[model samples]
Target: MSDARQYFDLPSPFAMKRGGSLQGARIAYETWGSLNAAQDNAVLILTGLSPSAHAASNAEDPSHGWWEGMLGPGKAIDTRRWFVICVNSLGSDKGSTCPASLDPATGETYRLNFPDLSLEDVANAAQALVKSLGIEQLACLIGCSMGGMSALGYMVLHPGGVRTHISVDTAPQAQPFAIAIRSLQREAIRLDPSWHGGQYGDQSYPDIGMSIARKLGVITYRSAMEWNGRFARIRLDPEQREEQPFGFEFQVESYLESHARRFVRTFDPNSYLYLSRASDWFDMAEYGNGNVMEGLQRIRVEQALVIGVSTDILFPLEQQEQIAEGLQAAGAKVEFVALDSPQGHDAFLVDIENYSRAIGGFLARI
Candidate 1:
C-alpha cells in the first residue's frame, strides 16, 4: 500500500513556548473521509504520547492502527460521517519533526540540544496544520492521555477553535503521583551509562534504561486488579525461566519484558525524554493564575464528554470530574462518565464496548 501520511510545513522560525524555536519544522498527519464544501464536519484526534498520525487504516495504508478498533468507516469515530484527521504530536519520533530529526542548522540530530518542548508547542503546531487544511473550527476535538492536556492547550491558546470535545483518561495537569512516576522514568534513562548524556548512537543505545522505564510505565498504565486477574501468581515453566539468579519468574514479568523490548528500539530515547517532561510540565493552572479550574473555564466549547476509568491511578476519575466541572462552568453541556473497567488508565483502549456506546451515542446526536 502507498504511504498515507501527509506533511504540513510550519511557518519558518516557529517559536517555542519555552525559550527556543525551530526554523523548518513540519507536522505529520493523516486523513480519512472527504471534507464537505462547508468544511464544518471535521473531527480532529490528538493522540497519546506514543501514537502516530495513523489512528486508523485506509486504502493507502491497510495496516491496523493503535486505535484500530475505535476509529473506522462505521466505528465509534465513523469516517463516513466526519472528516477525520489525526496529527502526530510535534515532538514524536513517528514521522514528525523531533529530536531524531536532523537539525538543518547543525546538519546533525538535535539530541539534547533540541529546544525545551511543551504541550503548548504541540497544540500550536496542530492548530497550524488545521488552518492549512482551511478548517476554521473543528466540529469535535478528541484527546486521549497526554493528548487531552494538549487539547486543553489548543482550546486555551486559540479560543473558539473547537465546537465540542471528548476527553479520555487525561488530566488538566500532572498530579504529584504522576509527576513522581515520570521523574523516575526519566531518571532511569538518564542514569544508564549508555545514555551518555543523549549522545549515544544506535550501537550504544540505552536499552536497559529504556526497558526499565517502559516496564515502570506499563505497570501504571493498567490497574493492580487487572494485573492480579490476568497473571494470578502464575509462574513461568522451568524451561521458560531465566538461567540467571535474578531473572524473570512470574508471568507478568515475562509479559512486561516482551512489551518493553519491542518498544525501546522503535522509539527514540531523546524524543521520549522531551515528551515525558512536557507532559509533567503542562498545567492549566499556568493559564489561570495558579488555578487549574479557572484555566479550564477559559476554553469556549459548546459541549463535551469526559470519560475516565475508576481504576485509573495515573489519571484518577477525580481529574475527569474536574474537567467536566470546568467545562460546565464554561457554559458547555458536559457529560462525565466514570467507567468500572479494571484496565485502569488503559481502559479506554481496552474496553471498547462501553466507550463506543458513549462516544458513538454522543456523535450520533451531533
Candidate 2:
C-alpha cells in the first residue's frame, strides 16, 4: 500500500514550553478531500494519545484507519464536504518528532533526554501545520479523548482560529483519580529492571513493564459493565490455559494480555512515558486564575458540541457538562450529549452510531 503520511518541517529551533529547544523537528500529518477556494471548509482533527495521523482510509492508503467508521465520503466527518486534516501529536511514536526520533544535534535518539512535552506544544505544532496549509481559520476543530484537551489549548493560544469545536470524551484537567492511575502506570514501567532509565535496547526491551502499563491503560479505557457483559467470569479453555500456577485462568486476563502483547512492541516505551506525562500535566486552569471553567471560557468559537459517555470513569460526563457550560458562557452556542454507553471512555470509538449522529448533526447545522 502507498504511504499516505506527510511531513511538515517545523521552524528550526522550535522552542518547547518547559524550556529547551529542538532543531530540525518535523510533524507527521495526513489529509483527505479538497480544500475549497475559500479555504474556510477546513476541519482539523486532533487525535488522542496513541493514534497516528491516519484517521481514515484514502486512495493512497486503502487500509481502514482508527476512525474509519466515522470519517469518509459521507460519514460523520465527511471528506466530500470538508477538507480533513489529522496530525500526529509531536511526542507520539507515529512518524512524528518524538523521543525515539534521532536528535539532530547529537546524532542519537533523544530518549529520556527529550525536552518536556505538553499538550500546548501539540496544539502549537498543529496550528503551525494548519497555517502552512494556508487555512486562516478552521470551519470545525474536532478533538477526542486527550486531543480535546489539546484542542482547548489550541483555541486558547490562538483565539478565533476555529469557528466551531467538537469536544469528545476528555477533561479540562487531569483529575486526581486520573493522575493516580497514570502515576501507577508510570511506576510500573520504571520498576521493571529492563526499562533501564529509558535506555533499554530492543533485545532488553521492557516487555513486562510495557505489558503491565498497557494492561492498566486497557482496564481504564473501558468500563466494568462492558467487561462483565463481554467476558463475565468466563474461564479460559483448559487447553488454552497456562499449565502453571497463578497463570491465565480467566478470559479477561487473556484479553488484556493479547492487547498488551500487540502494543508493547509497536510503540516506543520512552515516547509512551513522555506523552503519558504530558496528559497528566495539562491543566486549563493555569490560563484562568486556577479555574477550569474560566479557562475554557477563554476560547472563542461560534458553536461547540461537547460529548461524553456516562460510563467513562477516565473522563466523566460531568467534565463534558463543564465544557458545555463554559463554552456557552463564552458566548458560543453549545450542545452537550451524555451517552449511556457501556463501553466507557472508548465509547466514541466503539459506539460509532451515536457519535456519528451527534457529530454529523452538529456539523450539518454549522
Candidate 3:
C-alpha cells in the first residue's frame, strides 16, 4: 500500500518566513498503508536534509527509498499497522516549494531569491498539509537530524497533538560547531562561479559546490573509527596512483570521492542550502528566548525515544543526555538508547541490529 503525489494545491500565497515569493511551489509526499476508520493511525516521518519526499515502498521504484531498510510491513515502522506519511520540506528542492521552484512574478526559478525559512515555518507547512489531509493528531512524529529539528518545532508549537516522538541523533538547538559547519557548506556553494548565489541551474546546477558540501557532511556523518576500519593502511602506491588514468589516491579518499560524486548527482544545490540553513537556525528556544527547558517542559507527549550514537560528535551523547534529563524532569516517559557503533552519527542508518531491536521494542510498547 505505497502511494505518492507530486504536488497539492493550497489557495494562498506561498511566501517563506524571511520573505520572498515561493510562487506556486508544490510539496511532494507519499503515504503508506491505509488510515484506520478513526483516521488516527497516521504517523508522520520527516526526512533528514538531502532526502526528498520518498520514504517507503512505492511503485515508481518499489525497491528503493532513503529509509527502505528500516520501514516496511514487518520492519520497525511497520506499514502494516501504521499509515506513514513523508513530505518534502517547504524550501526543499524535491518538488517542494524552494528556491528552485518557479517564481510566478519572474516566471523563473526563485533561486537565491527564496527567503530564509525557520524550522517553525517548515513545521507549520507540514501541519497545514496534515490538516488538509484531515489528520488532526499524529500517532507519532519521527525525525532524524534536520528532521529532528522539525519534530522539535512541531512539539513546541503544537503541544499534546502528537502522541509520540522519536528524535534521532540531533537536538532542538544547533551547536556552535554545527553552525560553523553549515556556514562553511553554505560558503562552498556560494564560491562556485556558477552558483550565482544559488541560481545555478542554467548549465546544470553547481555540482562541484554541492559535491564539496556533501563531502564535508560525510566527514561528520561517519566516525573516524569506521573510516579507519574500512579504509585503513590502504594507500596509493606510485604504481596505483592514477595522476590521470591512474589516479593518485588512497582507498579511503577514493571511497569519499565516489560517495561525493553520487551525492551530487542525487542532490539539489538549492535544497541543500535551504535544509542546511533550516538545521542551523533551528533553536526551538530562539523564538522562546533561548529557554530550552522551558520549551521541553511544555511537551505533553506520553512518551519519547531519544536515539544517540556513542561516536556521534555531531550530536554528542552529552546533548542527548541533556534532552533525556530535561524530559524526565518534565515527568514524561522518555528512554535513551545509545548504540555502540563506529559509524558515528550515521549509526542509525547503517547499524541495523541494534536499531532494529530498539525500534521494534518501542513500537511493540506502543
Candidate 4:
C-alpha cells in the first residue's frame, strides 16, 4: 500500500477554496508509449472516478488494458502511434492521495481531513504532471465522466495546451440530479452508526455505511431499463432469490445487494465520500462567475467531439449536447453525437462500436 502511494508527485501546490493550503496533496500517475525527440507525441487521457494509472499494458494484467478497445495499434488512441499518459487525480483514493492517506502533520490518516478538491484543482494538478513530462502541448485531451469534466476544464484553464478534446458522456458542470444522488450516497456513509464521522475505529470497519453508499452509487451509475431487463422479477428457484440467505423478495433487491457487496470489497468508503463530494461541488459556471459562454470562450482547441448516451440518467445526452454547444460557441470546430445505447451512462464504457466509430472518425480528421 505504501509503495503504491509513493508513485506520485507530492506537495503539488493547490490553494484550496475550503480554507488552509494542503501541504502533502499528491497526484498518482503513469505514462505509456514514448515522448519522441520533440516531445510532441504526448496524448493525455484523464481517468474517471475509479480507474487508475494502468491505462495500457503492464506486467500485471498485460493482456491489453482498460480503454484497450479504443486505444490500440491502428485503433483510435493507438499506443503504437502516440504517447499516452493517465493519472489518478489528487482526491482519488485508488493508490493516490486521499482521505485514506496519512497526513504528514499528525501521522494519522487524512480521513475526513482531506480537503475538498474541485475539477479545476484536478485539472491544475494533472497539468503540473503533464508539464513534468516536458510536454508543453498535447495532441489530444480525452476523458470520460468526471475525467471528461477535467478534460474540458484543462482546455478552458490552459487555453492552448491541447489541440483536440474528446469528451464522453460528460458535462461542464455536474447536473442537479447528479449532485442530489451523490449527496445521498455520501449521506448514506455518514449516517452509518459505525461511520463515526468518516472515522471508523481501528477495529471494525464501517461495513454498513460503505455497503449502503456503494448501493446508492450503483443505482445511479446504471440505468433502470438495464435493471428491469436484467433482473425482470425473475427469482432463483422457489420464487425467491435473496431468501434462505436472510431474504430479499424483489429481484432488484438481490441485484443491488450483489453490486453493493462487490463495491464494498473493491472500494474504500472514505474514498467514495471524498470523490463524491468533489463531484457534487463541480460547476463550470463558477469559473466564469456566471456566464457559461464566457467560460467556453476561454478554450482555444482546434476541434472537439462530445459523445452522449440516450438512456443515461447520470449525464444525459442533453448535457453532452450542452458541452458541444459550449465548444461550438467558443468558435471551436465542434461535433456532437448522441450514441444510441440502452446501457445508460456506462454506455461509454460498454458500447464499444459506437464509441470507437465516433472517436476514430474524430481522431482521423485530426
- Which runs of model 1 end up more than 4 angstroms from their true locations? 1-3
lDDT of 3 at 102: 73
- Comparing 1 with 3 on lDDT, the higher-scoring candidate is 1
Model 2 per-residue lDDT tens digits across residues 152-234: 99999999799999999999999999999888888888888999999999889889988999999999999999999899999
Query: What lDDT does each candidate get?
Result: 0.93, 0.93, 0.77, 0.76
Q: TM-score, each model?
A: 0.98, 0.98, 0.93, 0.91
- Residues 243-275 of candidate 1 have per-residue lDDT tens digits of 999998999999999989999999999999999
Q: After superposition, which runs of candidate 4 have C-alpha atoms over 4 Å from their true positions?
A: 1-6, 11-14, 60-64, 238-240, 243-246, 250-252
lDDT of 4 by residue, 250-340 (tens): 7778777887787665666787787777777767776676766566667788889889998888888887887888888878899899877
lDDT of 1: 0.93
Q: Which stretches of candidate 3 lie over 4 Å from their true place?
A: 202-205, 236-240, 244-247
After superposition on all C-alphas, the RMSD of every candidate to the true structure, in Å, is: 1.3, 1.4, 2.3, 3.0
Model 2: how far residue 347 lies from native, Å:
0.5
Scanning candidate 1 in windows of ten residues, the lowest lDDT window is 1-10
